[model samples]
Target: MLGPASVQDLGRVGQYRFGVGTSGAMDDIALRAGNILLGNDENAAGVEIAFAPFKLRFNADAAFALTGADGGAELNGRLLPPWWRACAHAGDILVLKAMSRGARSYLTVAGGIDVPLVLGSRSTQLRGEFGGFHGRALQPGDILPCDRSESPDDAGELGAEPADIALRQRTLASGARRIRVIIAGEYDRYDEAARQLFWHTDWRVTPQSNRYGYRLEGPPVQPIVPIEKRSHGIVPGVIQIPPNGQPIIQLRDAQTSGGYPKFATVVEADLWRIGQAGLGSRLRFEPISHQEALAAQAEVSVYLERLRASVRLQGEL
Candidate 1:
């Protein structure tokens, strides 16, 4: 019931088989962090807000956590920080300022949003218009039902541990963004010069970038010889090169398959970086071995486990 633009439920995972796009949160790490703060399932439904000077009036008391984007959240006129959790009484107004960093923010309420799950997920597939809050972005006067009963007493006021706050700051800090890629599919088709250019050149995200894919603007990457490839199954993170020589990084809402030549696939651990990268952001690619990719994922798992353990311990306090 608030925003300056584009809000949707953070993606539907595990339902892509029905030709549905996995339209979840762009910054999954933030979504998981907020849910953990509120003791909700890491994948529990939450709102993904983009480009916001967002405001919402709560009609009921609730515990909520705000994560992603340093939007300068305020509850009842009191300033709040990202990764912070707090309580809101009935009629309290929550205001989130425009994004200062990162492209999206997540609002995870305790007990999660009480929307009917379709195919085991509550994410909105904007293209298909199903699932999520009436299959659309929330509007003013729209009443969203939440599972208030599922909220635990300690969910609010816990805030973020000093360590957690530091972690978020470090991850979202501005700098030359390096995204790791595990080489896959048709990578050999490109000539040596193009391959070197891919790794060494800085690519700028064009305005065409969206949840569907990021169309990058940089030096053209051309294959040594013309090749025609049939469309095959593809998933998020695959870098496809079209005839125009521009690179397109398929995202959560990407089509299931494409005829474009696939050069490289971003590792799962680094997709969140892409999600937070806005138009005009500079990105560089780093090649990693398959083992390195697996290790990266393992590191993420350990970090999540620590978050879970910390929340559990706090609940017992």
Candidate 2:
């Protein structure tokens, strides 16, 4: 049978036209751990479960791991935890439940998910609806074929967590409780109180958050006086404050330009956290020196080393 991170039904997602992207690991940190457990590459394509559990009947017995965002996974009525990699017997049912800690979870199989690599990756960009599982969510009766490539047989349960990332990107740094920002264009448009509120107040992640941007709902932190300035190119992590004063942080899939006035930007290292935070996650920003931001990146490199250490690669059978 096949394994995790293996993009099944390659070119299937791209053919569907599901807005241009298909689903991969919502939290890649979790997925990479699963791959390492299976002795596979981090890009190994698997079904990225969002808000629901994952269920797949293997054509053959294989080894796999479930990492991150506990959704009450059970194998033939036996409950399990995240960061677990074990061998599932043929016909044994592996079931994942709704989220308990994180919003999404990753399932990696041995030998990797054996989908034809399109454009060098099997990640389903569901927005583009290209690549991975017919460019859509895993559907029932979808027969995922296994690759002939054999994986190591590591008999154990262990892995590192996604929150373990030590890097504080220049683009997305946070302090567990507070988000940070780097002032950008249109910063001068706001008055003193507006600036204070923008930097010093707590905000709520609105239901409108997505890959395109994070819409933070908080007190109005807009310009006390209006300014007529042309729109400029927008980048991921830029906080675009409109007349309403609420800020929207753009993400990887965000558009290139916008007309709204932007005040600040989220640092780089911590940007991935936004994906992990989900729609209802409470958020607030903090200000940091540029040197601190770079230092955070160094910290991130260390954390990654620790995570790599925890990976239990499968032994040669």
Candidate 3:
């Protein structure tokens, strides 16, 4: 493992109210797609690989899917394409080389990784260390157990169209990915110029970015007048502007509360795009109405449903 690799599902929902943050797969769509391909539960736990050059050996006959980044994976030396699924025999080695696109890759088996649910989720809480496999990342010699009861018996090699292709989004002329956002409570605190800067600038994802949040590099987005507010509840996708003026996008493992000035929020539908964005990537923000955001979310739902139906049809054949 080159970077953090941990077991994650869709994440704990209701428990977040109890001070536990949701720590699920960053590229949730990828993970869900992998599970769907293998006929596993949509929220089945899978190994989320943040970085590449990862290798694993199956101890038993099984099927698996590789989704998210195209990391040049090879199953026992046979190259596999991104979003592809295939079966493996005992002792088969799966190796993932460097990623060519996106930031993370998900390895989902025929059955989800067998890990005890903590706070109703198997996702790793790196800070709390209470969930996932020991609530930590996978290290060498770490063997993961899988619940193979749901493994499909007649699954042949299957491939899925990547999310980027299946759900295309508009991009800025500068080639920066355009992420849709909705204005937040403190949007009016910033002057028109600051708002324009936030909208027009191609923010660069800094090295400080992680699952906790993404620290963007760009012209400062300071408010018109200094203002202080009490810390309030926050969630993934909330964009907060700190004293230094840089924007921080709270993500999957972000804290439950923060005091930073709210700017805008990346819609849930596009959170996967942010998750897949590699370090140093440029992203442009496009402000949209709340209704538009909901529409975008509906579009994603439709895509997933179509994929699920198609996979089920294939299995029936």
Q: Pick the candidate with the highest TM-score.
A: 3
- The TM-score of candidate 2 is 0.77
> Comparing candidate 2 with candidate 3, which one achieves the higher lDDT?
3
Better of 1 and 3 by TM-score: 3
Candidate 3 has which clashing residue pairs, if any?
none
* Per-residue lDDT over 1-317 for candidate 2, one digit per residue giving the tens place of the 0 to 100 score: 01122242112233222233223444556666677677676667665555565676666778888776686889888987667788887798888866666555667788777755665467654455556666554566777755636765545555455553243234324433456667776777778887888766667777777656778887888685765567566656778877777788876446556778878777765665565666666667777778877776566566656666655332432
Rank ordering of all candidates by TM-score, starting from the highest = 3, 1, 2
Off by over 4 Å in 1: 1-14, 161-174
Q: Residues 82-112, candidate 3, lDDT per residue (tens digit)?
A: 9999999999999998887788999999879
TM-scores of all candidate predictions against the true structure: 0.91, 0.77, 0.98
**Candidates in order: C-alpha RMSD to true structure:** 3.1, 6.1, 1.3
List, residue by residue over 1-317, the lDDT tens digit for candidate 1.
Answer: 11223334556666556677777777777788888899887878888777667788888889999887777889999999777889998999999877767777788898888888887678876677777787776676667778888876645576654222433323323455788998878998888889999988788889888878999998888888866888778889999888788899998778877788989999988888788787888788889999999988787777778878888898888
At residue 289, candidate 3 shows an lDDT of: 97
Worst 10 residues of 2 by lDDT: 1-10
lDDT of 2: 0.63
